[model samples]
Target chain A: MKTPALIVSGVLALLLAGCATRRVDESPVAAGQTTFATKEEVAAADEHDDWDTVAVVEVHDPIEPVNRGIFWFNHQLYTYVAKPFSKAYKSIFPKWVRHGIGNAYENIKYPIRVVNHTLQGRLDRTATETGRFLVNTTAGVGGVMKPADKIPALADVPKADTGQTFSKWGAPHGPYLVFPVLGPTTTRDLVGTAGDTALNPVAWVGLLFGGAAWTTAISAPSGAHGVPDQMDRYDMATKDALDPYISARSGYIQYREAASER
Target chain B: MKNIFFLLLGLCVGAMTSNASTEAAEANLRSTIDQVLVVTKKGKGGQSMANQLTPILVRHMCFESMTRRAVGPGWRQFTPEQKAEATKLFSKLIIRNYSKKFTPGELAEIEFLKPSSPGAGKVEIPTKTVYKGSRYNITYRLEDRGSWLITDILAEGISFVANYRAQFDVLVRKGGAVAVIASLKQSLERT
Candidate 1:
C-alpha cells in the first residue's frame, strides 16, 4: 500500500513538472502601457492617448516555416477528412439533439472553467459558474438545457480556460504554432490545452476504465465535432486574401488576445 | 397639485419613450441579421455579401466611435478626412470578416431575447444562435444617438471591439497611424 501511494505521488509530481516546463516568460509590453485589467481598458487608453512615437510589439514566431507547413497539412486534413466526418455527424444528429450533447459536454467540463476562474481570482465567476453547473445538472436535466442562463444574474458568466488563466498570470505566448490536425494555436495555448485535458473528468474516468484508449475515444469526437465549422470559417476568412497564412495568423492572435482578457 | 400631476405624467412618458426606443433598436438589429441571413442563404459570394451588408452595417453600427476606440490615443492625430478614411477601411474589414463567418448550413436557427439595459441610453440585446451542434450567445451593445446604433458586439462575453483593439494597439504602438491604416488596408485587400 505504501509503495503504490509513493508511485502515484511520484507520477503526479512528474505530470505537474511537465506542465511547469511548458510555461514561457511573460511577453514584453510597450512603454507607458501597463498590463491591462481588461481588453476594453486597453481600447479606452487608445481612445485617450495622443499621437506619439511608436514601438513594435513583436509576435514571436521562431518556427514559422515549420508551422506553415503543418498549417497546410492541417488544412488538407480538415478539408478532406474532418469536414466530411463532421458533415456526416451533423446529418445523423438533429440540431436539438446535437445541442443537448454539446451542452452536456460543456456541463461536464465545468471543473476546467471553475478551476481556471478561481486561479485567476475571479471569485464571482467561480461562484456563478458553480451555481450554473448545479442548476444545469439538475434543473436543466443533466445540462441538456441551459435554464440557468435565463436567470439575469447568471446570463453572462464568462467561459474561463487554462489558457486565459496563464495569460492572466503573465505567461507569454512563446511562439505561433499550427498543430497537426488541430490547426492554429500558440505555444501557451498548446500547454493550456494539455493541462485542461489532464483536468477533464471524462478523461480521468476513461483512464480509470480502459486507460488511454477510452480517454482518446471519448475526447476525440468532442474535438472533431467543431472542425467542420472551423474549416468553413477559415475558408470564408481567407476566401479573397492575398496570403491566407497571414490572415489566419492575424485572426488567431487577435482572437486569443481578446479571449484571454478579463 | 396640477403641476405635480403634470411632472409625474412627463416622467411616465419618458419611461415609455425609453422602452419604445429599446424595442425599436432590437427590431432593427433583428431585421439586419435576417437580411444578412437571407443573402447568405442565397449563396452569394463574398463581395456580394459584403456589398449588401456594408450599407446596413453603416446605418446601424457606430463605426466612428468604434474606430476611435480601436485606434486608441493616436486617433486625435488624424485629420477629419483621415479619420473618415480609417473608419471606412475598418468598416470594410469588419464587413468582410462578417461575410466570411456567414455559413448558411451551420446556423440552424437564431432567436432574439429581450433587451437588457446596461446603463442609461445603452441596451444589450442578447441573441441565441443555434448551429450544427452548439449554441452561441451574442449580445449587441446599442447606444441611442437619436436612433439606436450598435457600438460593440459581445460573443460569449468577448467584445469584438476589444479584440480588434488588442491587435490594433500593438500595430499603432510600433508604427504610427499610417501603419495602422496600412495594416487595415492590407487586411481589407486580403479579404
Candidate 2:
C-alpha cells in the first residue's frame, strides 16, 4: 500500500522540483564570476585597486515549495527511516547477501556503462566495464572481493559517455539545494529519483517491500556495527563548521568530484 | 487470484509468527559469533580472523550514505572532468575513513539483541557494537523486501542521516555545495 503511495507521491514531488521558476537577477553566473577572485587576482586587483568593480555574484531561482517538500520527504524517509532499515539488513544477511545486493546493483548498471563506453570511443570505459562485470560477478557475488580487486570500473566512465537514457531525457541540473534529510541535491538529481524508480527492477524482483523488508530487518545489526566510527568522522568534519549550508555545499562539490573519478 | 492472495496471506502470517519468537534469532547470532571467536583462537594465524572479518565489518559500515549525501547534490554542476575527479577522490576518502576506523589493535564486537514490532512497513532490530572495547547500543530500522536490504543505521543516539548532515552542512557552509565538493575532492586526491 505504501509502495504505490510512495511512487505516486514521488511523481508529484518531482513535479514540484521540476517547476521552472527562474530568478535571473540573483544568479552569480548572470553577470559572471566568483565573488572572491583567486588569491593572485585578488592581490593583483587590490594592487590595481579595482575593489569598486568587484561585486558579489549570486544565482537567483524560484523557491519551489514542492521541491522543498519532496526534499524533506526524502530526508525523513532516509534519515529517520531507510537508513535505520539498512542497518537492520546488515544484521540479518550473511556476507553473501550483502555481496549479492552490491553485485546486483552494479550488474544492473553494467549495460548502461557498456553503452556509455561504446558511445565515448574510450578504452577507459570498456576497461572499467570489464572490471565491473568480472568483480561484480565473481568477487562481489562471493562477498569476498579483495580490496585490490574491488575497483568498479564502470563507475569510472566519463560523464560525457552518459547512457542513452540520460542524454535523451536527463533532467537539466537545476539550482543546487541542500535537502533537509537527503542532504545535497540539485533539482535535476531530485527528478532523477523519479526516473530511477521508473527503472528500478526491484518491483519485479519481489524484494522491494515485504520480502526484502524482513531480510533487512534481520541484517540490521551487521549494518550498525560501525555506525559509531562513521559518526566520529562526521563529527570531526563538522564540529567547527562555520556555516552548515556553505560547508554542505562545498562537501557535495567535493563528493561529486570524487564520484566522477570513481 | 484468490489462491495467490491466500498464499501471500499465509506467508505473511508465518513471517509474523516466526518473527514474534525472536529469542531463537538472538541465540542463533550469539552462537555464531561465539563460534567464530573460538575458531579465531584455535586458528593458526590470529591475522586470518581479522582479515576475514574486518573487510565485512568495514564494507558493511563504510557509511556509503555519508558519501551519497555528500555527492548527490551538485552532481549536475560538475563537468565530466570535475565529476570524474570528484568521484574517484571521494571514494578514496571514504575508503580511507573506513581504513582509519578498522585500525589494528582496536577491539570491536557486534551483538544482535532482539527485533521490535515493525513500524511504517519496517522493523527495528536492536544490537550493540563494541568499538575499541566500548559497547554502544545500535538500532537498525529496516524497510521490508523479499530479501532484506540495509539502507540506514543508528549508533548510540546518532542516526546516519544526522551524521551525514553534520558533514554535509560543513560542505555547504564552506563553499555552497559546489565549493565544498571541490575541496573535498581535492583533499581526497591529495591523500
Candidate 3:
C-alpha cells in the first residue's frame, strides 16, 4: 500500500512539474527565458569564450622553459598524430555513437566526480551525481547511452574534479606546466590530476586486476574520443593571437578558474 | 481515455509542425553565417574585417541583450548613457576579438546537424566544422525576436556568453560600469 502511494505521489509530482516546452517556437518570451545570471548559472553555460576580460587570474609560470617545450611537443603531436586518428574515428562513428561513448567514459569517472563533490561539501550535487550514476548504469546499458541526460535533476550539471575541489579550498595555483600528451596543468592541478587518476575505476582495474590489454584497448579510443574537439578548441583559443603561448596560458588559467568557481 | 488519445494526437502533430519550423530556423541561421563568412573570406584582417562583419552581426546578434546579460546584475546600476556606451563598445570589442579568430580567405567546411527546441521560441542548432585542418563542434543558440537571432555560441562546448560574463561580472562587482567600460576600451585597443 505504501509503495503504491509513493509511486502515485511521484507520478503526480512529475506531472505537476512538467511543462510543454517547444522547439523553435516563435514566441517572444522564449528569447528572454527567465534563466537569470545567478552565480550558479555560469557552470550550466559551459566553458568560457575567447574574450579577454579584466578579471584576470595571474598564473605563476616559473617553469616557462619546460612548459613551452612540452606545449610545442604536444602541438606537433596533436597536429601530426591526433588529428588524422580523430578524423578517421569520427568518420567511422556516427555522432550518437560517439556521444554515447563519451557519455560512457564520463559515467565511469563517477567516483572522481562524486568524491570531489563531497569534498567541496556540495551534498546536493553529490546526491544527484549518485542518482545519475545509478540511473545511467542500470537503464543506460552500462552508460553507453545517457538516459540521465533527459532527467531534469541531472541535466547540464558540470562534473566536479579534485582540481576544482582544491581551488574551492583556496589553494593557489603554483607554476604552470604542460605535459607532452596530457597538455596544460598547474602544479596544484597536477596533484589533483594524480589524485583523480587514483580514484578512477579504470586505473584501479589496471593496477589490481592486471587489465593491461583492456587498458591499452580502451586507452586508444579514449585518446581518440576528444582529440578533434580539444585540438580545434585549442586552435580557436590561441590562434591568430600576437603570442600563441600567452593566449593558450591565459585561456587555460581562465577556464580552470571558472570551472573551480562553479 | 478518448480525451487522452486526442491530446496525444494533437501533440504529435504539433511536434511535427515545430520540427519543420526548426528546419526553417536552421536554414535562416546558415544563411546569416554565410554572409559573415563572405566577409571573413575577404581577408580584410583585423579591424577591417570586423568593421565589415559588424553590420551583419548587428542585424542577427542582439548586442544590447548580450551587453545586458554579460554585465550580469550590475547592469541595473548602469545609467542609460552608460548602457548605450557599453553596448556599442562591447559590440565592437566582441566583433574585433571574434573576427580575429578567422584567418583571411579560409572557409571552414561546416555540417549542420539536427536542431532542437529547448523551449518555446528557443532553438539550438549544433554544427560540426572542419576548420584549418581541425574538426570542432559548434552550437548556435537562437531566440525568436519576431525572427530568429543568435543569442549565444558554443565552441567545443564552451559558451561565448558565459566566458565574457565571467570576466565582466568580476569587474562589475569590483568597480562597477566605469570599470567595465574602461576594460572594454583597453581590450579593444589591444585588439
Q: How far is B127's C-alpha from truth in model 2 (Å)?
A: 35
Which ten-residue region of model 3 chain A has the weakest summed lDDT? Answer: A17-26
Q: Is candidate 1 or candidate 2 better by TM-score?
A: 1
Judge candidate 3 at residue A31 and give its lDDT.
30
lDDT of 2 at B11: 91
The chain B TM-scores of all candidates, as shown, are 0.85, 0.50, 0.93
Question: How displaced is residue B32 in candidate 1, in Å?
Answer: 5.6
Model 1 in CAPRI terms: which quality?
A: incorrect
Best candidate, DockQ: 1
Q: For model 1, name the residue pairs that clash.
A: A46-B72, A46-B73, A49-B73, A55-B173, A55-B174, A241-B190
User: In model 1, what lDDT does residue A191 have?
Assistant: 74
- Encode model 1's per-residue lDDT on A1-262: one tens digit a residue: 3454355345443433111111011243343332212334334555334111111123456577898899888778877887788888889987777677778888999999998888778899999999999999999999989999789787668788887776766566656778787678776787789879877898897868968888778877666655556766677545544346655665576556656764
Evaluated against the true chain A, what TM-score does chain A of model 1 have? 0.76
C-alpha positional error of residue B46 in candidate 2 after TM-score superposition, expressed in Å: 27
lDDT of 2 by residue, A1-262 (tens): 3454355445544554331212122222332211222334334332323221211212223443454565557545655666576566657766455554554554554544565455434557677666656665665543233231335434333332231222223223346665654456655555545555344443334465558665456444334544433444444344333333433343443333223323
Query: DockQ scores for all the models shown?
Result: 0.15, 0.02, 0.10
Q: Looking at the true structure's interface, with contacts defined as alpha carbon pairs within 8 Å between chains A and B, what fraction does model 2 recover?
A: 0.02
Task: Name the weakest run of 10 consecutive residues (lDDT summed) in model 3 chain B.
Answer: B157-166
**Candidate 1 Cα outliers beyond 4 Å, as residue runs:** A1-58, A153-155, A240-242, B1-54, B58-96, B103-191
RMSD (Cα, Å) of candidate 1?
Answer: 8.7
